[model samples]
Target: MAANEKIKEKISHLPHKPGIYKFFDENGIIYVGKAVDIRKRVSSYFNRSAQHNKKTLKLISQIQDIEFTIVDTEADAFLLENNLIKQYQPKYNILLKDGKTYPYICIVNERFPRIISTRNKINDGSRYFGPYASVTTMNVVLDLIRTLYPIRTCTYNLSPENVDAGKFKVCLEYHIGNCKGPCENLIDETTYNQNITQIRSILSGNLSVAKNYFKERMAAAAEEYQFEVAHQYKQKLDLLDDFQAKSTVVSNTLSNIDVFTITSNDKCSFINYLKVMNGSIILTQSLEVQKKLDETDEELLATVIVQLRHEFESTSREVITNIELQLPLDNVTVTYPQIGDKRKLLNLSLKNAMYLRKEREGRQEKNKDLSEQREIRVLETLKKDLRLTELPRQIECFDNSNFQGDNPVASMVCFKNGKPSKKDYRHFNIKTVVGPNDFESMYEIVTRRYKRLLEEKQPLPQLVIIDGGKGQLSFAVKALKDLDLWGKIAIVGIAKRLEEIFYPGDTLPLYIDKKSESLKLIQRLRNEAHRFAITFHRSKRDAGTLKTELTEVKGIGLSTAESLLAKFRSVKKLRELSQDELAQEIGQRKASILYNYFHNVA
Candidate 1:
């Protein structure tokens, strides 16, 4: 490897401490690696005939810059490196990636802390317990907490000074019995802190203490003959037990084991993650990605494992998947279980992955069918409204722009099966029309268009839309009749004022439903023709102005002017050239005269 000055300078600063290093280039970070000794690992690339493969050598050559984060141990380096890889997806490293950050359960730091789930982690002295894989689990925790404790959900400050000064009162939460008037200092700080402590323990999967507390309270209430209070306590105890029973933690022996399962088809893949802590699945999440390069299932699964584990901050000693994956992760036992609780965990993970994949597929198919139905309905409505024998699947629209007759032009836009057909579109230069007469311009284009189609033996459209009121439509009809093709084609005119549709042999115009898809389609066709014609007219006017201005020169004529335009493309470019530069194309005398005219030299 060639050690450029940048690499040598960067390596000189590398410390001996273990850390994660990132190789950044002009684009961004392209490679990331973890090492025990930062200086030795990074400098190894600079040695004579570098001790690395072709890919590593290529990566080394592109390393314009480098950065490192110091961690205390090799384990910390591994965790941090894996995390950086997942986040940046450095091209040189192979790691699973996910698109989102899973939510966490946070207990806010306030006089009366509220239990809330969030994707963003704020370091404001609050306790955050998770980067949960599934929001459902956090939701269940919140519901149980609300039922077990009469905590305040309000945003009022319950500071001792504020409460003593009588700045706040009990709100709806107190009246509804969801809070114990904490803002009014009815519930002391000591009792509130104790409840919050137990809640933290419950979230950490140590639910026995909280359950026992609720059970004891229930028993005391029953002994005191307070049936309603006893019932409430019993309900809270049951909720905790029921939540635990659903997951069915076999034993509290397992901790920090990540189980993954993946399902993929020809075009995409989905993965499910199960974060097993104290033998119960604490976080359940599934993510899907579109298959762009047709990656193997094993490769995709391994990538997902790294991403999920790192994102949830799992430093599990063991990692499990339904498939036997050969990953390069160190100090982690990657296993495929075949029987017992481990097997059950694998199966559950697989079930979730498969279920999510199926649900996504169903939603796509349902959306496609609904879209097709809406299109079909629009066509049917158009057919009925226009009194057509069949659907007008092929439509043509025309618009004329004259710029007050300086360079009259027209454009025709075609729509086949309700979509713009650019290949079938045509532009007319108003060749036979003398001036800005809309009726005459429309008649000329219609006649020439059909006459050529007849000569070429091409197909005719089911509908020809004229963008004007009755006068343009009448001229178009006259042209069709002159060609003895009046009854063969279905033609209509759209009035710009009220958007009224004019039919042949009908005095009154037909007004379609304003909100109808048919009206929208018709409007789209008219607008497209207008946009196309205006663009062509502007270009023609520009070219005409250029032709007139260039021809006004003493020695320039039609061919000379067009040739100069062909070479220069525009007047601005010709104006930018020097006299000697212009003399290379034209004679010295003509160049001098052109330069004199432009520079205002008499």
Candidate 2:
């Protein structure tokens, strides 16, 4: 028997319960999988020829061993799967790295509190309506408040110092009738407060009452010979007409949904979302990211469902591209309705995704064609030109910034699919080499970079470009060779003699193929990385505050200090932690020690 077959046979006796599973290769790489029935789901994978797609086939072949845990139900299993996926980032799962928790819209606590969309949701004293998808969408709805009702947008506080400031002065918003000049106290507090309440009701979609009140106001203003006032009210009514027309229809049947889309480029991928509620599309956002190291479409869809479930309450039905999740949709219907309104909606969403993918892919192909032409032109003119083994998917460029090496820093910026991935930009402080030693610093940075990559097992970039000439190029090459990552990543150094580029590994000045989409793309990526790296380094060198307050904590050395600071924003906040809270935040022993240290010192 094969090595993996023996292992799978051993675990064949696993109970048929809902839980997470772990798959391991002989080389010891871990890939965690999950299922509702651990025994059945796992055993299914053991069958070599039993129907599997391309991605699944690859995963099954790599599986050398299997392990699982039994949970209470499928729902519990779903949560466990996502938790494990996030903690481990398994090789075969989609990963959501939004880097931000969702934002909630809150009406703060006060007699006249501000309605603001905030990422921080606190129960201190406020009402929160939503964890909206984007700030832009939330703000768009908020902007409608002026047209809906006469809400006071001004600060209610009339401090003694600013009492005179509230004196009448009709601002532009007032002339436009968007505001009632509440900042100038033209409107009384009682009226303003009443207006605020009405505005809130309108925002909640109480359309009938809002329209009735507006009609009454328009009629009353006309009777009072206030033509301008009547016209303003008439305009608001017209605005509401537009608002209702554009607003999504809310169906009682569809309470909550997560619409999915899978889009891809020449390299990497994308998965977008349209989170519906009460039949209205409440939120539409791309999944944190569509692709990870070894993530596939179906696998990503599954991971997204599990991860998304963590952020939301359990829903009765899930609308998907197909039945992919381990969730038992037997009682819950999984219908790909052929001739109905549902199918039409699904098809529309799919078409939107396909169009988005094509647009992205088209741009990339255009850039690729451009880059190739540029490469040819350079080769023709210089007789020595850069050649790639494959079309560069990830191109990296390095640039340094410092004040005479006093605050020496370097950045490694990355581009994927001819576009800059600002998220992947990295910076390094010139630690080992001293004072204007660009070559040695480059060598140190490159060495440390590859060393980290080796330890972390991260995918290497397709191409590496340095923003300097032969000496810097040689330094980078030497570092890569020393780390034995030389041939794995392409190395190129670009230098400008006035407006001309001098290529690495050659003495000749290079000329790019003006007509090549690919060559132009490379230039764009290289230039962007250089710009990004310089911007980051300058910002650091400009601000002399590289030190963190966590360094002052007695038990917290650099690593622990950084971790503590990152977890709790500041040393002051860390100090605010009670013994129990501190223990929970960090650890009991460390927390106690730090607390005592601070107390005794203070």
Point out where model 2 deviates above 4 Å.
Answer: 1-13, 24-29, 43-67, 150-198, 201-209, 223-226, 249-258, 261-270, 276-280, 287-299, 306-344, 381-602
Candidate 1 deviant stretches above 4 angstroms: 1-103, 107-120, 132-137, 146-198, 208-237, 249-254, 259-272, 286-343, 419-460, 469-486, 498-500, 504-520, 539-602
lDDT of 1 by residue, 1-602 (tens): 33488788889999999998999888999988778899998888668435566666777788899999999887677668777876788776664445667788889999878888888898899999888756777787788888888878888777788889999888878888888887888988899888998899888877888988888888999999999999988888888878887765455676668888888887678888888777777888887876433557985676567666667878788888877876666778888888887887788888999999999999989998887787778777888888887787788998999876678889999988787899989999987778789999999999989999898998888889999988999999998999888888889999999999999779999999899899999999999999999999888887878888988987767786787787787788889999998888787988888888778889
lDDT per residue (tens digit) for residues 427-515 in model 2: 88888887888899889888887799889988788778877787888899999999988788878777655333454467776556656
Model 1 / residue 29 / CA error / Å: 13
Residue 15, candidate 2: C-alpha displacement in angstroms? 2.5
